[model samples]
Target: MKRSIALLALLLWLSTVALVHAQTLPSVKPEQVGLSSERLGRLVSMLRNDSEKGQIPGAILLVARQGKIALFESVGVLDPKSKAPMTKDAIFRIYSMSKPITSVAIMTLVEDGKIALGDPVAKYIPQVAEMQVGVEKPGADGKPTLELVAPRRPMSLQDLLRHTSGLTYGIFGNTLVKKQYLDAKLFVGDPTNAEFVDRLVKLPLASQPGTMWDYSHSTDVLGRIVEIVTNKSLYEFEKERILDPLGMKDTAFDVTDKAKQARIAEPFPNDVTIGTDTTFFDPRVPQRWQSGGGGMVGTVMDYARFCQMLLNGGTLDGKRILGPKTVAYMTADHLDGSVAPGPLYLPGVGFGFGLGFAVRREAGVANVQGSTGEFNWGGAGGTFFWVDPKEDLFVVYAMQSPKQRVYYRPVLKNMIYSAVVKPNGK
Candidate 1:
């Protein structure tokens, strides 16, 4: 009788632990969340078909509505080379998606009165004050020449958050300033955040701060600021304040643990190039540069919690990450008519950049289907997510095909909005 009682108690304890482990976002039927089950099935089938055709190595997509998961599906293998089946908890290199998290980190400092958005970036990193803009001018021989000019105004923290800080990604363009960035070889030796910023500040700005929307190393600089202000590494501060409290156990700068390394998703060997010449980094290898712009890996469910927090007005499961008003402020459009959309106009038509997201400004101007208030951003490694406040919905799509990201992002967006059979809480 004593042995049986002990066995029962052990089993009960195990079951209780399992329940606690499973207590992420609750799962519910598609109908319960006002999504069409058939439509969601079609979306999954399309992804599966794409995988089977070898168009992609694998993918994991999560769609949640009304604060409940309506669909969570994994298709294809975790790695094309290993042929390991993809699992729901498979990790992905979320690249630029790291920006939003870093942006949130900066906002947390703002909330605590440690930083202000209007504060000049030079206030944190003094070298930034010496930075100058590069303008192309016609030389005596009629060839284009580079001229360095002082910025009209200093770059503010808000400028970094909205990507209007006159920074440019070298890989994206071949202008004089961009060429300087490439010549610097910023990522050559796996420089630490401080070293990276020190090298970056020496480069000429692509445009005057607050005058252009150019996607660049602004977030990476923000990561250095986090380190400076908090007296902790970017990952350390983020993990403690944001990831730990939000139950984002699998999100980090890299997959350092031997156990979780197998779960890291990979792209098809042939489809690895991001731009014309650049390739995606290996997430399995740990690095000191915790790139705030593009260096974080996470599972779909882990990101789902992050998105849920955004959709829930910056709180999840009673843990308030940021106040509702702050979330709204972050999501609202920061660009005005004066800010020029540079050569790489990433936000596209009908969208304006918010703090760290491309917020839809209208219902019809954008080529893709989405609500006006929806804010979103994506990774270079084919991971994308969006939060539609109007529909009370959010979707996270994870994959590893960098070359196919542009094509698939819109296709996935159109398909997801199509799955919403009922809208506006109907």
Candidate 2:
């Protein structure tokens, strides 16, 4: 009896050990993956000091490489009033960071033959059918002005993905199209299918489709098209196609559970040189519009899974979401060597709008030292993410505060470069 009892006890011990091992992340050590915990700590300290100095409320960051997650850290209070310190599981308004995820979902549909990239958007969403373009201004004397007319070439799904669909943001500086968008009450409140289509259709194009690269509501329009193509709401399609498949349980368009709301970090305000006084976090409440462009909440781990899937050539844990070629095409710059004028935030950058994020220009220009063929983009808030194929690396950073004041990516790049394995792969 004593011998039997001892054997049972040993079995229990082994089970506990296995449970611990399973719960632990894959063995991607920081040093092995070329990361310095010391540098990471300093980065956290900087964020905390910034919060204490009233620069931001909080921040969260994660670093992963070679199918392993190394660092997941958070700094500052999730809620300043309650003083709840941020945790790894703390939720954040990912903002434009949601774009890439949504884009991935769209591409998954593409892989399934649900839609084609070059197919005219009007083929699915009738709203874009017969879409018009802007031309010359009317004369003050009510006579004909120099009318610049052109064929209304059908805007393709590729155009929507590339922001070449001639759509413009209503909030972007005061312009003629901006005025039209405002007057149409577009992007004013929680957008609906009919309301969004009506307002967007009435607004004239900023430029002819495929003629310019203007950062606009093309993603939101793409979201609507996804609904038409899939016969499911954008929210439903994302849940069915991407989130559930990847075990992204915490990510969603809306906070459905009360417990999740407690974890949802507050969106802090910042100095915005453009648009109205409205900030992302109105004292800890989520925004009304379930905007596809930038309206989802997620944790670092959840987002890392999405990025990891991309880094793994569109498969994670044997679940193939995109073809390897599709992943490569998405990361490759697609702007045909057309340089964006002015001091764009990403210097030496070229546009390659695929499913949702910007593809990197090349191994040259506007890249971190270790960023070889890396593709990345960020949110209006401090949230940023990148996938470095050359290193099989994935990274995500999040913070509350709706302004483009901080340049966190470069700092992160420097930190990453410090940890690159020596020539012999360390």
Candidate 3:
């Protein structure tokens, strides 16, 4: 009788935990949210046709408008090899989508007066003060050589948030500085966040601070700073402050639970290369570094809550993660004409970098269809999300196809906007 009572207690506890993590958003028909059911069917057919053709293994998409989920869909298999049917709860490696989460954590510190945007990054991580900029100049043999020069100014916390800290991801470019990053083998052993930053400061910056907007490891540096400020692991601080309150129970740097392991999504075996000779990390393997830039795995529902929180001005289910004005400040464009975009500008045209998102500056300038205030970012692993304040809409597309991400992002954006027949419910 005692053993039965203990088992019953455990089951009750698990049920209560599930209730805590349950989605708070209401579900409605697409039409109720000003979305055309017929048009949405077309979107479903496209994904299903692609899955049937083996173009994609599978995917889960959640479209929410006016604080209600209009379309929550799953198509294709979770694992192409195992042929496990794709489910709404399937976990995906969110990659650089992790940046927005890390960025939000830093902003929470900002809200608490723990850190200032204009403060020099070296204030928190002193090693950054010693880093130099790498400039390519002609050598005696007339061949271009890297020249390390002092930065015109120190990199501020804002610079890191905006990707203007002059840091470059080694896998994307072929510059001398990037070659040095490759030579360093930064991820070979999965160093702790501190060790990662230590090796990074030893390398030269790609440009002078705040001069260029480059997709980079700037968020990773911000992650280390977060660790330093809170005296907690990046995951720990984020969990306590953001994830737990938002009930993002499934989003984490890694997945270790045996039961949840079965839900991990996988891409096609041949579709893994992200950049020049680089592949996505396996989230199953435990690592010390919680790469704030590109090392998180989560489900579509978990991310929807996060997006909803941002859309609702940093509050969800009565829990305020950030102030409304802070959300406005974060979503507004930070870039102007002066800051030149780097060659690998991930924000594309008609958009600018905000704190953690690519804020759209115009509705018609870019080939894609989105509102002027829409802010978004995608992951190297193929997950994508955007929150359009103008449309009262947010969408989360979760997939694992690295090579096909760029193509599908625009396609999905165009199709989603096309289906908005009522235009913010008229």
1-426 per-residue lDDT for model 3 (tens digits): 999999999999999976765555689998998998888888888998999899999999889999999999999999999999999999999999999999999999999999999999999988889999999999999989998899999999999999999888889889999899888888878899999999999999999888899889999999998999999999999999999998888999998887889999999999988888788677788899999999999989989999999999999988899999999999999998889998988899889999999999988889899999999999988999999999999999988999889999999998988889897857
Error of 1 at 320 (Å): 1.1
Report every candidate's CA lDDT: 0.92, 0.70, 0.92
- Give the alpha carbon lDDT tens digit for every residue of 1-426 in model 2: 999999999999999885554333475567776666676667667777887886777878777776777777788888776888888788877777877877787788888898888898778767676556666577899754444344368888887777778777766656555566667767677667546766787667777777666777788877777777788778788888777766677787767677777887765433433354335633144444556776777887788888888888887666677899988877765555442332122323533544566666555565455454677777776678888787777778887666633466677667765655543134
- Candidate 3 local Cα displacement, residue 45, angstroms: 0.6
What does the lDDT read for residue 79 in candidate 1? 92
Model 1: CA > 4 A from native: 1-23
Q: How big is the RMSD of model 3?
A: 3.1
Q: Candidate 3 local accuracy as lDDT?
A: 0.92
Of 1 and 2, the candidate ranking higher by TM-score? 1
Q: Count steric clashes of candidate 3.
A: 0
Q: How many backbone clashes does candidate 1 have?
A: 0
RMSD of each: 2.2, 4.3, 3.1
Worst-scoring 10-residue span by lDDT in model 1: 15-24
